[model samples]
Target: MVRRWQPPWRRWSVRNRLMAMTAIPLAYLFFTFLWYAYHSRLSEVREELAERGPLVAKVLADSSEFSVIARRHDDLKPTINGLLRTDPSIHRIDVLDAQRRELVAAAARAPGGTAELRYYEAPILKRLMWVAMLGPDGKPYQKDRPAASGVTVETIGYVRVTMSPSALLLKQTRRFYVELLVGSLGLLACVLLAWQLAKGLDASLQASMQALREADAEKRRLIGKVNTAVEDERKSIALEIHDELNATLIAVRLEGQRIADLSPEGEVRDKAQSIIKLALGLYNSGRSLVRRLRPEVLDMLGLEGAVEELVRHYDSARSGCRFDLQARGDFSRLEGDIAISAYRIVQEALSNIVKHARATQASLSLALEQGELRIRIADNGRGFDAALASAGIGLVGMRERVYALNGSIALETSPEAGTLISIAMPIR
Candidate 1:
């Protein structure tokens, strides 16, 4: 047999499951969105760095071109200050010749020493080459940019520019706060949506479970009604057969006896006796059938008496098997479905023992204690597996009958250890 599947999450109630479904998606999306934002910031910084290289190179080339060509030491400081006054971003500047000799330099010594420096170099272009390849902003020359021509010049030296990016780093820090604010807002939105969805899902599941529970209760009620109706019909049939049919059979038997007594002592007399014997056998069979249908002894003797009679009947009928019946409390008032269901349960169990158990001894108990009816039927026979008993139609009928009375049944069985069937019924 294939075992049933039990998922780990099934341990959680519907509410928790809904919460998880709601929260997990929002959490995933929040992290993923923040991750994308972080990478975007990195990419922006990289692009800014790329653009900075060209800007620094252009600044050096423009500021130092005339100074390097004329070899004027006095003009270098003014040129460097002019560059510094235009942009607060620059923290250091250096001008170098083609021979790598420093022509002029400026440094800002902060309390924390020099910030990390980035390097840039540009060659002083001849006047024609400058107009062709260099743009005014010191970017690569483009057709749309302004470049002056007709100036005579040549490559005098290379100008190097060094700059610190502390200001840019601080700007990025401010941007991080803005990014955090945006992320917080997005997370709040996601949480609100997720909570609403989770509540809706939980409500839906609760409604479904409620509907299913009502349906199940209704089904059990219907089954109990059907079982009671069938039982009533059986009782009627048994009464009809017992009262009318048995009387007719008895009358026929009495007539046969009369014929046997009147006839002469010969083959005719023997035939009459044979007819009487057959009629007697049929009467016995009809009595047994009536008992099977609905034992009249039940109504006459009460539950305890009926149970004792049943055990005695079984003990006499079956070979190599003993049936024991024990009881306590006043069972005379035991009536309605309770009585019928209990009697049928015992009847079916005994029939199974005779047909299948091959046991040497069996016992049945009917006790009323503390306003509850307890029934236990045990047999010392070659035991069977629980699967076999569960699959038995007889056991199934017994269970249904017991459940119709809102009772419970339990079975304890293993190979050669005998089977114990226990039942408890609420009498009040």
Candidate 2:
């Protein structure tokens, strides 16, 4: 026979399976949460960089406009360096003239090679204004004319700021680690709870199985008691018939014979002869009934002789089936219940063969070995479908008897293959 393969989880215990089932989903959820949190935090970091980079560039442009117009580049270095020192995220700052020449530059030390940089720019503007309305006498010239004034804005320089996100990324990474730790702890707790639940279920199942076994044992014990009681009743009935009915029939036969001998060749003698014949038939029937109820040969010759006598009787009946018995080992000291159960099992098997098998040959084998009695009954009959056929009373009785004695029985049969019954019973 080839064994089929099963999945690895199929072989796991209930507790393990339950824990795995619980943990897998929790782990998935944890990973999903981490993924969402990482992306969300990254977006926040980007937004902060966008807002802070532009504002710092604009402020530097406004502050450096006057210095750039006066061509005092050296004075602007201190402010640019101070801005870089205050914010570690600002990687570099540059001030350029109208021709895009770097007039002053300040840079902070780069934290890592992989740091991402963002750039923001703002233009430095100079406002020029023209003044009119100056009369020759410096006095107000009241004329019905609107005053004309003009102002012009000109780009003088530009401020460019470079920013890095290494600090924000580090902070996000630390937060993720903390969340992962908490999620792992929660998943482990769920797995432990699942294990505990599985343990409880397994314990309950074991208790139920134990109860069932005890019930089955009690049932077998009750069956053995019933069988013993029935056998005792049968023996009592058989004794009554043997001692009372058969004796009465024998006496009636003797009286009829004497009456026939005294009355010579008359109607009375013919009637007496008929009476004697009827009495003899009744006596023979009673004796046959006694043998069936309780075979006396079992007490005299033990189980082997009783079974042999049974087989011989069946064989002599000429029921179109040949019966054979093969015996081994001594059965003299066999236990009463075991012997009787074994004999009854064989008897039932043979009866079934004769009444239903339509077999040409049947064999019974008995062996006593290692303090156990083994019996096998086989017949070359047109066997029925054992799976489909409802078990007959004879088979049920045989099975109950064997089970009551803590023995085992197996029946093998199929269409056109014949039937075989194997049984084993302890001697003690």
Highest-scoring model, lDDT: 2
Screening candidate 2 with a backbone cut-off below 3 angstroms (N, C-alpha, C), the clashing residue pairs are none
Best by TM-score: 2
Give candidate 1 regions above 4 Å deviation.
1-201
* Alpha carbon deviation, residue 27, candidate 1 (Å): 16
Q: Whole-model lDDT for model 1 versus the true structure?
A: 0.79
> What is the C-alpha lDDT profile of model 1 across 141-168, one tens digit per residue?
5667656656666666766665555656
All candidates: CA RMSD (Å): 14.2, 15.8
Backbone clashes (count) for model 2? 0
* Quality of model 2 by C-alpha lDDT: 0.87
For residue 311, what is the lDDT in candidate 1? 87
Model 1: which ten-residue window has the lowest total lDDT? 107-116
